[model samples]
Target: MSYRSMTLLRFCSPIVIQARHGHRMRGKAPDIAKSLKERLAPVILDEEVAKRNDIGFPYQKPPRSAEFNKRFDHLKKQRSDSSLEKAARTTKLQINLDDVKVDWFKTAGPFHIRKIAEHYGVYDDLFGKYAYFVPRVFLDIKFPLNEDTVYPVYNGNKVHPLQAKSVPEVSFEHKFALSYSQKPEENTLWTLILTNPDGHLTKENSEYVHWMVSNIPNNDISKGDQIVPYLQPIPPKGTGYHRYIFVLYKQDKKLDLSSMKVTDLKDLEKRTFSTFDFYKNHEDSITPSGLAFFQSKWDESVRDVFHKELNMKQPIFEYDFPKAYLNYQKQFPLKQPFNLYLDRYADPKDVNKRYLEERLAKTHPFEGPEKKLQFPNAHELKKNIPSWKKTEIRKERLGRGRINDAV
Candidate 1:
């Protein structure tokens, strides 16, 4: 018996045998051509291509394990408990404002303060009035796990770039150290206002109040009542950087803040807050005491904080890539070699020369006569023409199927 027949007989013990004179039976099988074609056929990946072209895959952070969740809850509870206990203790501590002075403003007044305001276009027509009172309040950000450090407040050396995402949940602490020449009086009442002059959508002398405490007794902010509860800085993206100004005013007496136009926190959004106007209106009642400010930008944490804490929707940023790019170009103007070939052959005159002349005319219209354009010498032109003509000839020859002979 054949090997195949023997194997089939072993596997199928109940098979019926048909006897024939020197004849073997064969089973039907698949077509070899058809099988090969199916195996070698090209795969169409249109669906995969479409999926790749569509929106990006959603990134869902993996859920924390039970133990991790428990630990996080415990830490959160501990923080809340400790914060309450600290607040209770802080309320009892006596804060002295008698030694505090607004002299820090004088040191920063000439160039530093103005430069910062000018950088963000925060100054107005009445900038000079409040300029002298710009304070030297030291600001610090305390992170959940890190020690407090001095925040960048108009001082370039110590100025730190605050990332928006990392700071929303973090609270900042500020204290005013008296300048040497000035002394605070015990009977003097003060007002503290923290605002973002560049927070408005439109360029106006407006500000969004982050924190406002009026009738502060002797610069003790913790003891004072909050007119506008502390709203952490939420500098929206694409608005560039924002300046969070902490302005302290020495009130002649306790301000009857009930008469102010914006008495409620809800009315503080995009409020017209001009330092000059405020000083002018209350010139008799309030004097500029101290001023401190820091810059901030949008971060990922802003979305959550805005919606949850501030009860506001996150603003959709308008991408200003072109404007930013133009500004960068202006700052570092490109110094590239002039395209002599294009200038000489493509146009009747040097295009770059014309463009420069036109720009100069617009910049200095009343200046002397237009400067002359000096063209390249004949020797320089002769040196470059041969290479250009050779390239053109080679290209022409290649098009005509005579590339082998052209070179």
Candidate 2:
């Protein structure tokens, strides 16, 4: 549901308050004042509101098993147990998990492109709520191209390997078309939509050109040479993030992208330089410098068009979640504090311990007599765990006489 609709509905609901009991009264003396206070009572949705909205989520059904019914009855008894509630009320907020920090923003050139697009007059219309026409932020979304597949010939555990083969004959025509009588500044950021050979959509088939103001020369609203990649997405199997960068450079006089109030070309002269050249030229006549800027830099980075997308940063803050199994009694009211104990054994065995260790290293990474010593390697503990061969036999005292024992 849209946020606006939910907000409107909530506004019509009544506010609830708590009241206190009066002191010992004789003959039930009349009270004049009313109290308006919210207490530690569970906030339940009003039945009338629920009925009016036709909302019936998770309706309870009669228990089908006697064992489940007995457990449910036991829980009801626990709800009435005041001792449990008192203990819960004393709990405090405690998060035991190591905090992690990562760069959430990944796409590099989108930053510059967006700034320039804004200067050129159409970023607002084209990009809308998204951070520019292209969202550089990774949202854990995956594509089928990166999915691991096994071949029958090799081991079943390993994914089929792939390599790059230059196929000069395999070429595709890429074109950028823009039409705006409303002036360039009033138009939207250009969007490039890609389609497969059989007309199905592919990841590399999509791209956006946003104005990058920081790199622009004095916020000049100029339309530069259209960008067309000689090579594009090559189908492959892999398991990593990849990035494609596109940079634009305007070769002519500064162009005015602002909307024209008079609908005339008179203001065009004031925007551009007198000596700047303009005209359609052949591909050979034009020279480009930063064409090969998107080369991969890190182990996680790949030059291939088809690869996984990863956020450069990790989630900054986190809180230990409250127990879902515990139906809060009065003692453990809303916003009550609690501690988290690590029951690490319950975690999946395959979880990447190295990743968690790396995050912990950033926080409090060391343990030694010297405070400055670096944190001990997590994997080191596995090898250093006491071995039977390394243990030595020690002599015992007379009172605790060294008897012929298993040791």
Pick by lDDT: which candidate is best? 1
- Tell me model 1's lDDT, rounded to 2 decimals: 0.51
lDDT of 2 by residue, 1-407 (tens): 69999999888978889999888865533554332343355679766544422111121233358547876998999899887777678784343332211121222443443454445422222222222343221111111233372222110111111321111111111121122222333222221211111111222223321112111332222332212222332222222222223322222233333331122222212221110121112112321111111111122122222233211231122245554563324534455322112223224222345434433554553552223224322213244644431221111111121121211
Writing each residue's lDDT as its tens digit, candidate 1 over 172-267 gives 222322433345344656777767766765556566766677877654566766666666667786666667766666666777655443554444
137: Cα error in model 2, Å? 32
Which residue segments of model 1 deviate by more than 4 Å? 1-122, 125-184, 202-204, 259-272, 320-407
Count of steric clashes across candidates, in order = 4, 25
* TM-scores of all candidate predictions against the true structure: 0.42, 0.17
Which residue pairs show backbone clashes in model 1?
100-178, 101-178, 135-290, 135-291
> How much RMSD separates candidate 2 from the native structure?
29.7
